[model samples]
Target: MLRIMLRHISLLILTLFILSFFSFSLAYLFPGDPLVNLTGIRDSSEQTYALLAQQYAMNDSLFSQYWHYVNNLFSGNWGLSFSSGLPLAEEISRSLAASVELSAYALIISFVIGLPLGFLSGLRHHKFIDYSLLSASVIGYSIPVFWAALIAILLFSVQLGWFPLSGRISLLYDIPYDTGFILIDILLSDVPDKEFAFQDALRHLVLPSVSIAIVTSTIVLRITRRSVVEVMNSEYIQAAYARGLSPRQVFVRHGIKNALIPILPLLVMQFTTLLTNAMIVETIFSWPGIGNGLIQAIYQRDFPAIRAGMLAVSALVLTFTITSDMVIQIFDPARRRPEDATS
Candidate 1:
């Protein structure tokens, strides 16, 4: 067990090192002068371009600069944004919660709704309901997120006027970004009409969150259906059925947990995917999240913000991957042989 833990830690460390190097290298990959793009100051008036490079340590060797960036990252000094001239870490802190909150809602929507439907479709097997679910999953997975988001905005926001077009809250509420999580901040705030503010925030969340959920949930449904069907076909499940137990009893007692083993890892991967997709969704809906900020950073060539964003995201993905492995190993004790446990 200790050996396995050590191995995971070592791999995580090594992967992070590689990821950090790659993220740092991204800044240097700009086609032309990154400073010029970031600052819009050329060889003409306000030729502080040379000074800017020195200020940001762009004059240093690539290795030296990367080492510095890594040191700063570790020491909680994420440097400054090229565009806003704000602290990169602070900006990320402000944006991180929004992205995470949005993704969390989407993740919940995918799993809460997808799992039951999957189990039902799997149990139904060759029935009409099964085919119907399969078709829906395929169509949901096929649709592009951006296109779906646009349609949602056009139909729901513009035409029906059921939801807001963009932003996390109604413009009427001048609530500060207290915790970055809109709903939470609205509650903690001493503002009047708390219930109204909360409702508006929730309404704003529904469209984008549902759009992402529709896409991500499809994959979850497919994976879960396949896993459940395979588990149902297993000899143990058949034996349970032969013992005169009801199908529901057999599935609840013997099949459900085992079926989860395969989908467990996939679910975590889906969270990572959720975060990735949230970037585009956030940008489209003008969400105040890390995804939107990262998109803007790329457009403006904000090297500090870009590199920091990459590092943070890469680290999160690696962490989630490791966590998923640990969860799987723990969930399926059958994998832990006597010899392995003794070791």
Candidate 2:
């Protein structure tokens, strides 16, 4: 078990190192001077260009620049943004908080709605319920996330006026940015009309959250249904039935527990996917997240922001993948077997 964990950790470190290298090397791969993009200046004196280059350490060799960037990243010094001139770490912190909040809400919604539907579909097998769920899952999976978000805004925000079309909260509230999480900040705040602020924040959250959840839930639903159906056919499940356990009892006590073994790893991967999808979702809803920031950086040609954002996203995905592997090995005893470990 320890060996497997160590191996996974080592692989994770190597993957991160490679990811960082590529992210840094992206500047060199593209044509033209990166400083032009970073500075947003088409014309500058030679001295001014030299100063900007030196300021960003662009004057250094590729290897030296990457070494410094990696060191700065590890030391929590993401450097200043080229456009805004704000500390990149602070910007990332704010954006990351919003993204986390949005993703967390979407994940909760996906599991809450998807799991029961999946369970029913699986229990029913080839029956009407199963077909209905399968159909829905396919349709949901096929819909583009951005289109879904737009439609949600049209119905929920524009026509119905049930939710806000953009932003994380109404401009009406002056909620303190304590934790960078508006929901928590609202609760912890001593602002007047705290309830109103909370409600407004929730309203702003619904459309974008649902947009992401609608797409991601399909994956959970399909996986859960398939896993549950397979688990139901296992010998132990048949034995439980023979021992006079009710169908519901057998399902609740035995089926879901075993089915979850496979579902967990899929869910972990789903988390990373959801974060990646957030880039589009955030842009659509104008949600102030790293995804939104990244898109804006691209448009403005802010290379520092671009590199940092991409690296951050890639590192997050890789970290989650590694963590999920370790968790799966810990929970699934079959994976801990000698043959499994060797394989």
Q: Against the true structure, whose TM-score is highest?
A: 2
- Per-prediction TM-score, please? 0.87, 0.92
Candidate 2, residues 84-187: lDDT per residue as tens digits? Answer: 89988888888987887888888888898888888889989999879988999999999999999989888887898888889988888888789988999999
Q: Which ten residues in a row have the lowest lDDT in candidate 1?
A: 37-46
Candidate 2: which pairs clash?
A: none
Off by over 4 Å in 1: 31-62, 176-179, 333-342
Candidate 1, 1-343: lDDT as tens digits: 6655666788889999999888767655756675554344567444476688775577888777778768878888887787888887788888887888899899999998899999989989999999999999999999999999999999999999999999988888888778788888998999989999999999999999998999889888888999999999999998998999998899889889989977877786788888888888999999988889988988876766887887887788788888667655555555555765666
Error of 1 at 30 (Å): 2.4
- List ranges where model 2 is wrong by over 4 Å: 35-60, 336-343
